[model samples]
Target: MLLKSIRYSLDELIYLLNQLSDKGYSKSCESLGNETIGEHTRHIIEMFQCLENSYDLGILNYGNRERNDQIETEIEFAKQCVVEIRTGLKSENKILYLEHVIGGLAIRIQSSYYRELLYNLENCIHHQTLIKVAVLKFQNIAVIENSGIADSTSEYRN
Candidate 1:
């Protein structure tokens, strides 16, 4: 169930990316300090990749992400990365630890792979919201239907 949810979130992003042209993907928005939609998409993909890479290491540190520029500017590359992440999530979930730093102090807490997947899904949705807004402002492109809204929020509309 968790993996399915993660895949759905990733698919939502891919669908949105597919609808954009190179200009829409790379265009910077003044409202967001000139940050492009590609940047936001890259950030979302990297967060999921970071968690996947650390799944077996017993310690997950989200701060240590590779912000690959290629993934940001290359729409096809970002789609491939999302596919890789979705494939990686097919494995069985396991207990893991999350490492965080608070006020110069490092803290490690117990967590599970499934929980981290949920976190990534939610994070992607939040980033998608920003991307959707930027895309709309940069061009008259139609945003993805329910791209960033949580499922629970949409359920109430019905």
Candidate 2:
């Protein structure tokens, strides 16, 4: 189940990456706003990579912060990250206790791999949609027709 879920996400991410690559980088008002498509792509993959690293080391990194600079799609960084994620998941570790802080309850907690993956998917999708909206708002281009978990495509050029 975990593999299937992650693979589904990987496929969605690949579609998004392809769209971003097709669009290339916008200069002023129709590409990707001030943040290039690569930037958004890298951010999403980086988030997942971090989670995978934390799971491997059994030490979760707190705070939702992005560290890398803006990237260009020529590097295909997002795809590389997805490949790494796939490799990591092949391990035998089925149960991962992800340590995270509960914001609303104001408590630290240890969550299972299933919860972690689900939450990560939700959070990443929200951020991805936000990036899509930002592009639409700044460039006046609807890169994506809709923003929903059910819609797997990303960065549709239209």
Candidate 3:
């Protein structure tokens, strides 16, 4: 079940990648949000890279080492992260599971080692929602399901 969820999330993340690829940085905002699509993608990359480094170092216990405010480029960052994630998954690491405290929370780290991949996807979704909302607000763009702007008879779809 978890694996399925992971795959689904991964697919969703891929879809988000497509959505974000065509988005321009012209979207104006007073301040960059904590988790924009680009930042979220970068965070996933960073998280995967950290996991890969820990796997390589055989370090069972690890810590969060966030050294930057946020990553602004999503496409290139996602590409790098996807490569690292694939490499890490292909490697033979039985002890990929470990318990560590993060944000003062003791979360159970699963051994299947697939959680990282899924988390990446889930995190992307978490940020994409924010991005979508921001896009709506920033551009004042209306979202219509079947009939798009062609049906301009609606009041911005509320």
Deviation in angstroms for 87 in model 2? 3.6
Q: Which pairs clash in the backbone of model 3?
A: none
**Which candidate gets the maximum lDDT versus the true structure?**
1
Error of 2 at 88 (Å): 2.4
User: Could you estimate the TM-score for every candidate?
Assistant: 0.90, 0.60, 0.49
lDDT of 3 at 89: 52
Q: Measured by TM-score, how close is model 1 to the native structure?
A: 0.90
In order of listing, the candidates' clash counts read 0, 0, 0
Better of 1 and 2 by lDDT: 1
- Model 1: worst 10 consecutive residues (lDDT sum): 135-144
Candidate 3 residues lying further than 4 Å off, grouped into runs, are 1-4, 21-35, 60-71, 83-93, 96-125, 135-158
User: Candidate 3, TM-score vs. the true structure?
Assistant: 0.49
Which segments of model 2 are wrong by more than 4 Å? 22-33, 62-66, 70-75, 90-108, 131-147, 150-158
TM-score of 2: 0.60
